[model samples]
Target: MCTVCGCGDGEVKVHGHKHHSHDHSHTHSHSHDDGLHFGDGAAGVSVPGYSQERLIKIETDILAKNDRYAELNRAKLAAQEVFAVNLVSSPGSGKTTLLCKTIEALGGQPLAVIEGDQQTQNDADRIRATGAPAIQVNTGKGCHLDGHMVGHAIEHLTLSHGSLLFIENVGNLVCPASFDLGEDCKVAILSVTEGEDKPLKYPDMFTAARLAILNKIDLAPHCDVDLDLYTANLRRVNPTIEILNLSARTGEGMSEWITWLRTNLAQKQLQGAAE
Candidate 1:
């Protein structure tokens, strides 16, 4: 289980490996008063019978192991000049739709997707429908995709050199921020229908993301959402984060996103060549 979020780390099944299972069990306790105050300790997470020092050590060890796996994943992708992007967002943020539109807009680009969810291969099916090769990873009871899971997913994909690889992470703004999937960058998507204070409420996600996409901008007026406020909040949390406003449904402001992708891909290829 994830000591940070207390989410069960059950079996993680990558597509084509139905019999594979990983059991990650840990002992932790949660207490509720007025609300769950799990962020009061030095480790920033509370667990009964564990001292702050112990908790910190546990978290550090876990992240260190994850980082090692992430480095392996990164090296593998870099060797092929594959630019991987980790798309993260809360549920109902139109992430899958955006990914579909992105694939369509890229035209004949060589790209693949790795879809992550707690259950079902619905999103992966949608991507495959667009005629792109996609692999579905079902993280049963796991809140987010980790480096180890992504690395395994890559083995199933015959990624082309200098192609783009998109990893659509499980819909959760909290735990995904703490996990790295060896992507070149993390893109956090937020819809206008959601609260403008989402950045404030989930500051860690925004801070961790390299870019923030404010999706569903076409419905901003109808949703009574101030686009500027959302941008301001994102900048407040991550001053250096690249922000893009676009609607996948309306095909508006999509050109900018495509250009960003192309530019990043070129840079990644250049880096690989230099190495």
Candidate 2:
């Protein structure tokens, strides 16, 4: 189980094939005090029989291993000159709709998608309908996609050179913030209906993201959302994070989002050429 979030160490499947199992064995005493304090440790998370120090060590070890796999995935993407973006958001953020629109806008562009969800290939089916290649990774009880999972998924994709790859992560803001999937940058999607205090509520997610997209902006006025306050809160969490306001349904600010993608893709290609 994830020591930080307590998510299960469940079986991960990539496109219906069982990839592997996250069976982490822990040797801790079963006895515990009746008055349990799980937050008193330095790690701020306490397992039943594990001490705070042990929890910190376990978390550190897990992240360190993930980082190693992330480096491997990064190297693989670099070799193909792929500009990868990890799209992260909460449930009902309209990420899949925006992605479909993005695929339509970037017509004939060499691009693909890796869809992550707890269950179902529904989003992957949507992406494939755009005539682009896509892979679905079902994380049964897992809350987020780790670098190792992404590495395995990439093996099934035939990515073009100098292509754009989007990894639509599972709809959870907390755990995805800590896992790196070898993407060039993380893009956080927030809908106006979700409220402006999302950044403050999930500061780690906004802080880890390089760009923030305020999706469903067309509904802002109707929802009585203050766009200015949303931007302010995002800036408070990540002072240098780039913000974009767009509505996938109305195509209000989609052109800017497409431009951002092309600009980054060009930079990645240029970097590859220089190397």
Candidate 3:
């Protein structure tokens, strides 16, 4: 598995639509930016014994390198007055669906997307259909988007000053919490179909997020999920996290989501003006 954050299989590869031709035939060495190798003790990288210490060091080094790149990305977004948000969730949590609806609600506001997945540009295509500039970042076997990868993506996307940029992180509640992509906020999405106890189960992800979107609420009547339990669990993990309930499929409670975005955007613009 990927030892960088213990998220996926070996060798994290980035596939950017603007720069790559989707070729998997290239030959290259697989290593984190800090020269640490991936996989589980293979390739003579991991220690034969006392493996926990070695893994800890590797994780530390990788995150340190990732943080440096994240700072650079943060600076770039700040300079442009762009409000960047990272969307993190497990698979089938309705992140892309929410993003598509959010883009539509944005109504041609200056927006761009950085879609992440282990494979496929399907999410990027969906965002593009909403008429927003989008770039797909296939992370190969990686379960998270590091700052270095997002920094490269920024070079290709045309983000306007005071605009909104969304980075849809790979579908995983675990590893994505360890890597920061310099987003202004991390929005964690959990659908009702998923258990209400998810926040309790994945405390790290919930604790890392600044806001929580309890989506697919329209189906709540059909599902056995308890909204109160979800909120309580979320608060238990992150007492200060803001939450918005909505259904992307039916557009229910979308107004509140749009208002939240606009409010954040306005604050960003105000800060930019003051600077």
Candidate 4:
């Protein structure tokens, strides 16, 4: 259970299927029975609980520990010159499909993926079919991927230096907003089939994201989503957030998306070199 979001208490398994020489991918599941219970107010101030100050302290302590882990992960990535991106969205937002398309577009590029889900290695399998290495981090009941979990997930897979690591977060926007997985950017995906007012409804996710991908544009004609209105709503929460409209199915506007990714990656490499 993630103390920050209280998503779930399910088990997390890192599955790395061997596909290459650098691939340490193996089929093994490890259960973590840590005593940290963030859910049910495990902060120890329950029922006729302790003072509000004590409650606040517990929350702060939890976040602080997570932050420390995040910082450590960031340092490790920096040491390897890996540009990590965190993908966050609601369920069925077409994030996995879009990633597969992106991987194909980035053919031959050094890329790795960290797939986060409550269960199933399905997404990781899809990514592997694209000829890229991927690690599946089953978050069990956890709604979001915290830094500590990500750090452990990285340990199981071998990511290339100067490569891009895509961390596909669990399919929930709210809880993921607060947890930092040491990503260089947070890209939120909003499908056209969903309400155009989603940005306003889920302000935390929208505001936390650096880019918002308005996916499924191929179905825009059949859907009721208003592109202009959606953009306006996104701006209301995040004035500087970049927005991209693309349909992973039709490959329309995909060049722009790929170009954006390459540009960011180049910038990251330059920064790493300078450092």
Each candidate's lDDT (Cα)? 0.84, 0.84, 0.80, 0.82
- Compose the digit string of candidate 3's lDDT tens values, residues 74-111: 99998888999999999999999999999988896898
The per-residue C-alpha lDDT of model 4 at residue 264 equals: 88
Model 1 TM-score relative to the real fold: 0.90
Report lDDT (Cα) of residue 59, candidate 3.
Answer: 59
* lDDT agreement of model 4 with the native: 0.82
Error of 3 at 185 (Å): 0.9
Candidate achieving higher lDDT, 1 or 4? 1
Residue 110 of model 4, lDDT score? 90
Q: Per-residue lDDT for 260 in model 4?
A: 88
The per-residue C-alpha lDDT of model 1 at residue 269 equals: 91
Q: Roughly what TM-score does model 2 have, to 2 decimal places?
A: 0.90
lDDT per residue, candidate 2, 1-275, as tens digits?
Answer: 44346655445667722233322222221112332323213546656687777666566767777888899999999999999999999999999999999999999999879899988889988888888888888777777888888887888777889899999999999889988889999999999999999999999899999999999999987998999999999999999999999999999999999999999999999999999
Tens digit of per-residue lDDT, candidate 4, span 1-275: 45544444655677775563333322322113333344324434353435555545555676677778899999999888888999999999999999999999998889889999888889999998988888888776678888888888888778788888999999997878878888898999999998888999889899999999999999988876689998999999999999999999999989999898888888888898998
